[model samples]
Target chain A: MTARIGVVTFPGSLDDRDTQRAIRLAGAEPVALWHKDKDLHQVDAVVLPGGFSYGDYLRAGAISRFSPVMETVIEQAKAGLPVLGICNGFQILTEAHLLPGGMLGNDHLHFICRDQKLRVENADTAWTVDYASGQEIHIPLKNMDGRYVADEYTLDKLEAEGRVVFRYLDFNPNGSLRDIAGITNEAGNVVGLMPHPEHATEPLIGTGRTDGLPFFTSILKKLVNA
Target chain B: MARVVVDVMLKPEILDPQGQAVQRALPRLGFDGISDVRQGKRFELEVEGPVDEAALARIHDLAESFLANTVIEDFTVKIEEVAEAVK
Candidate 1:
């Protein structure tokens, strides 16, 4: 059976097609979910792609977090549905409280776009099962508001519980606390990261490295065996 | 009708890069005696009808849920009457 992965497209979404293509390349059917639509169409998993949703008004992801589709996404995610939020999607997840912490302006106060190296601190999450623990891989990271911040207690809890799934390896690009690049919820079903994995899934494309293919393949494999 | 002002600011513990950039530029621009700077957002909401408890409560809810993210920022809501001079 082919796994159906839904990719949500918001008004300002720029990477939804790339994310869908990545999923298709991984042998899964891509479902296009709209921001205003609440129905998920029974997708096996969902990916919120990157972009400046709602023009990043008020705050990045602030307006989009309240979109009709996110209402269902949040509920399903809490019920253990596998959800991956990339870049702007990560911002929405934080704004919706589906994930902890909030993003702020980059420490350098400039938009950063580059290939970022990250270590897979925890490979057991629903979206990272294919990677070995402590594996380092490069993915494209881009955005203006990418610095992640949280209360001290919350940061300590995330560290103590091993919820920090991905940590910046060589250099901290955005001044995120403890060099965190991505994280997973306590259930390990929902993951959020400020990187564009879809852009790196095809070697013939921009970076010419398929380091991000495992993210889609990992989730597809999970759904198949289940 | 009443004018409600919402002020949102990052928590002191969190780093404010925009504020820091401004602080650094102040000295270069020949300004001194400024200890620090913190950037924030302010929203002015114009509510219709009486400025009663229910309306104030609703505004508070908006500030908590949408106007501000409690994770790294705090928000305060101030209710001010319309000055007669402006009217």
Candidate 2:
């Protein structure tokens, strides 16, 4: 059976379609999920794509964290369901308490858009298995509230547990603590990052490189193999 | 009806670039001597009945769980008196 990957579309989601396309490109069936729907459709994995969800009101991903779909995602994720949150999705993950820390406005207070370089620090996660540890790749990073913050203790704990999955390479785009571009939960089933891997999935598109395609393929391979 | 207020602000240790930008502009605007500036959000909620201790406590919980992200922000909840309107 083909791996069915669900992509959630919140009210203001901008990248849900692109994420679906990326999943299709990776040979997985893409299931469309609504923010208000509590059902997950039994998808093998879920990808929370980037966008200004709920128009970024009450904070980037704050209000959307209470959406009905998230209620199920949160519960299932804890039970070892594979989930990937990108950009605003990352904000939602943090707000939902599925991930530690929070995202704040960029240190320079600007909405930055750029092709950013990142190093895959952990390749064992559900969404990163296709990449080798320490591999450098470029993904499109764009956001106003992308600066990641957490208490020193939490930061130390994440580092000690090797939960920091991705790190900025050469340049720190949004001043994330320790140049952390992405991280995973202890189980490695949940991952969140500020870059838009969906945007970089096609070689003819955004960055003209397919570095981000690995994210989709990695999850698909894991699900199919499972 | 009663009015309740919740104020949310970033923790002191985190960087406040928006506040800093305003502070930087102050000196050029002839408003000097201000050492620092921090930005925050204020939310006013109108309740249907008396905001008793129990209600206040509920609002506090709301502020902690929804109104504020405790990871990066601190919040305070309080009752606000409604001002009488002048005819």
Candidate 3:
């Protein structure tokens, strides 16, 4: 049976369709989830796509963290539901308190959009089981508030727990702490990253490199085997 | 009336390429004397009423928990009787 995954669409969300396409390309059913809809549509996992939700008012992801669907996402994530937050979605995860730390403005105080290089730090998460730890991959990263920050205690905890999933391999674009490109919760189900993996899943549209397909495929395999 | 100021930033462990890029541009902008510039944002909030000490504490909670990222950014809170400052 093909696995079903849900991609949420929030107002101002720009990457929902791309995420859906990635899910479909990975041989999984892509279900469209609305921000106001509380049900997850019986999907195996959820991807909160990147965007400027709620026009990024008050702070990035601050207002949208209270959306109806996030309440359910938060509860289910705590119970070990697999969730991936990309870029602004990562912002929402932090805002919802599902993940540690927060995202701030780029250190240069300007919008940054580019193809970013990253190294896979931990490959054991629900969404990253397909990649080898320490592997290098390049993906597109575009956002204004993309800096990742946390307290020293929290950083130590994340590092000590092996929850730091991705790190900047060649260059640091947004000045994230410890060069952390992404991280997972203690349960290993919730993964949040600042890069746009969904944008790198297709061969023709991108550099013909599917460097990010593993994220979708890994979760589908987890569901198939579960 | 009282106000709170929160400044959040990224940690020093990571390289701030953007900040460095801007620092490099400062000399070319005819501001050759200026150097070493770093950038971040500031948020100032006005409290609703006679905010008790507990309410002020709540604001700090908001700062550390969600308002400010403690890892990359260091935040300082200043709770001054703005009514006196204004007068």
Best by lDDT: 2
Can you list each candidate's DockQ?
Answer: 0.89, 0.92, 0.29
- Candidate RMSDs in order: 1.2, 0.8, 4.2
Which wins on TM-score, candidate 2 or candidate 3?
Answer: 2
Whichever of 1 and 2 has more lDDT, that candidate is 2
* Tens-place lDDT digits, model 1, residues B1-87: 789999999998988888988999998999998979999999999888987889989999999999999888899999977776753
Candidates sorted by DockQ, best first: 2, 1, 3
- Number of clashing pairs per prediction, in order: 0, 0, 5
DockQ of 1: 0.89
Q: What share of the true interface contacts does each candidate keep?
A: 0.94, 0.94, 0.44
Query: Docking quality tier of candidate 1?
Result: high
Consecutive 10-residue window with the lowest summed lDDT within model 2 chain B:
B77-86
TM-scores for all candidates: the values are 0.98, 0.99, 0.79
| Residue runs of model 1 more than 4 Å from their true location after superposition | B84-87
Query: What overall lDDT goes with each candidate model?
Result: 0.92, 0.94, 0.85
lDDT of candidate 3 over A1-226, digit per residue (tens): 8998999999989999999999998999999999999999788899999999999986788877889999889988998889999998999998888899878777666788877888999999999999999899988888898878887889999999999999987778877778988989999999999999888998776646789899999999999999
For A6-106, candidate 2 gives per-residue lDDT tens digits of 99999999999999999999999999999999999998889998999999999999999999999999999999999999999999999999999999989
Return the clash pairs for model 3, or none: A150-B70, A150-B71, A151-B71, B10-B72, B11-B72
Lowest summed-lDDT stretch of 10 residues in model 2 chain A? A103-112
Which CAPRI category fits model 3?
acceptable
